[model samples]
Target: MLKTRTGILLLAPAIVLMVALLVLPVGYLIRFSFYLGQTGVQTSGGFTFANYVRLFGDGFYLAILWKTLWVSFVVTVVSAITGYPLAHFMWKAAKRWRAPFTILVLSPLLVSIVISSYGWIVILGNNGVVNQLLQFLGLTTAPVKLMYTNFAIVVGLVHIVTPFMVLSILAALEKIDPLLNEAAATLGANRFRTLWHIILPLALPGIGAGTTIVFCLAISAYVTPAVMGGSGPNFITTLIYHQFVTLFNWPFGATVAAVLLAVALTVVFLYVRVLSRLGAAAPAAR
Candidate 1:
């Protein structure tokens, strides 16, 4: 009883903080979503489902939601594909090389997202480094359209999220027993075979963690998509901003936010379910 009391006391502050900061705001946002709006402005308090109805009923909003999901999926996949090899290398590299490699992988995180987005803009812009290089190489007569495209947004998001993926995979890799690799080798298993059968299975948890984090972050990401994706390839966050700031439709903005929150939660739940199934099946496979 005393230990339980002490634990509760210790947790009280954190619980209070969570309620005050997160729960309260979400509750308020939910309430706000139910309010009615007119001509891009929220009216006096009255409960209505019109905002949600319009969000689901309209084709434009649905298209934006689909685009957001697609962009997030692409970013997560690219981050995982690029991060896995880098993480493996980091885990297997000599002690002297690990620090530098880790730093290189993590350097982007130390910088601000806005700065990073601008850096990508410089590299991916029409007259930027990439186009200049292509011109110098005599590869093209005109600059390639890189900026303000879905490809550019994906590239930026991949760059931002790759560090998270690498760290997650590295954490999992570090937990793996090196003896497992040696044992497989002694059993006449080749490197590729060991990696495919041993390393990958063990690393699925990390990959799943990284993918979930990257997907969540990418789906909610505003600055990178806004700056790189421009006006056409608008994301959910961008639409929320448009409703809240541009149009001053507070009720509708809250509705969009609620929908985004629901979608994010659904994706996370499905991802967890899938990962759990994979985790359960791995032991049987082995």
Candidate 2:
């Protein structure tokens, strides 16, 4: 009984912090969403569903939601495709190769998004490095129009999220028993067959986790989309920013944030369901 009390006492600070940082803000946002903002004063929780009703009526908001979903989905798919190969290489890398390879995977995370966005601006801009290289290689006479495009946004987001995906996948892949593959080989399984049957199945949890992380990260992104996506690839976050900062629509932004949270939670729920199904199937496969 004393030990339980002691543990609770020790955890009290963390619990307080969580409530202060997360709970309070979320509660306030939800509470505020049920009101109207007039002259910086929020009032009138009318006990009505007007805010949510308004959310569905707007076509632009719906477009932004669709775009956000599409962008996150594409980013997650691309990250998984690239991350799996890199993780496979990492698993098979020699001891000397491991350190350098790990550094390469992690190096992008060290650079700030601001710096990388600027770098992308230069690279994708007209008369920038990409155009210069293309021209020098006799590919084109004029600079390509690349900046302020959805493609640019995707490129920037992929670069940012790849390191996280690699780390997660690598951790998952590493835990897979090497002996499992060796045993498969002993049973006349080829390299590809062993990887398909043994390695990929074991790595599904990491894949699920990495996909969820990258999708959520990409969907909620503001900086890269602001810079690279510009007017072309507006997302839920950008719409929220515009509402709160530009339109002074705090209540609207709160509603949008609630929607964003719902979307993220939905994706997480689906991923969890799929992961659970995979977990159930794992034992039968073995």
Q: How high is each candidate's TM-score?
A: 0.92, 0.92
Backbone steric clashes in candidate 1, count: 0
Model 2 C-alpha lDDT per residue in residues 122-228, reported as the tens digit of each score: 99999789989999999999888888877887889999999889888888988987788889999999989988988897887898899999998999988999988
Q: What is the lDDT of residue 53 in candidate 1?
A: 90
What would the per-residue lDDT of candidate 1 be over residues 72-150, giving only the tens digit for each residue?
Answer: 9989988999999999999999999988997899987888899999999999999999999999999998999999998
Q: Of the candidates shown, which would achieve the greatest lDDT relative to the real structure?
A: 1
lDDT of the structure predicted as candidate 2: 0.86
The parts of candidate 2 lying over 4 Å away from their true place are 231-233
Ten-residue segment with the worst summed lDDT in candidate 1?
A: 37-46
Candidate 2 global TM-score:
0.92
Report lDDT (CA) for all predictions: 0.90, 0.86
Could you list the CA RMSD of all candidates, in the order they appear?
2.2, 2.1
| Clash count list over all predictions | 0, 0
- What does candidate 1 score in Cα RMSD to the true structure? 2.2
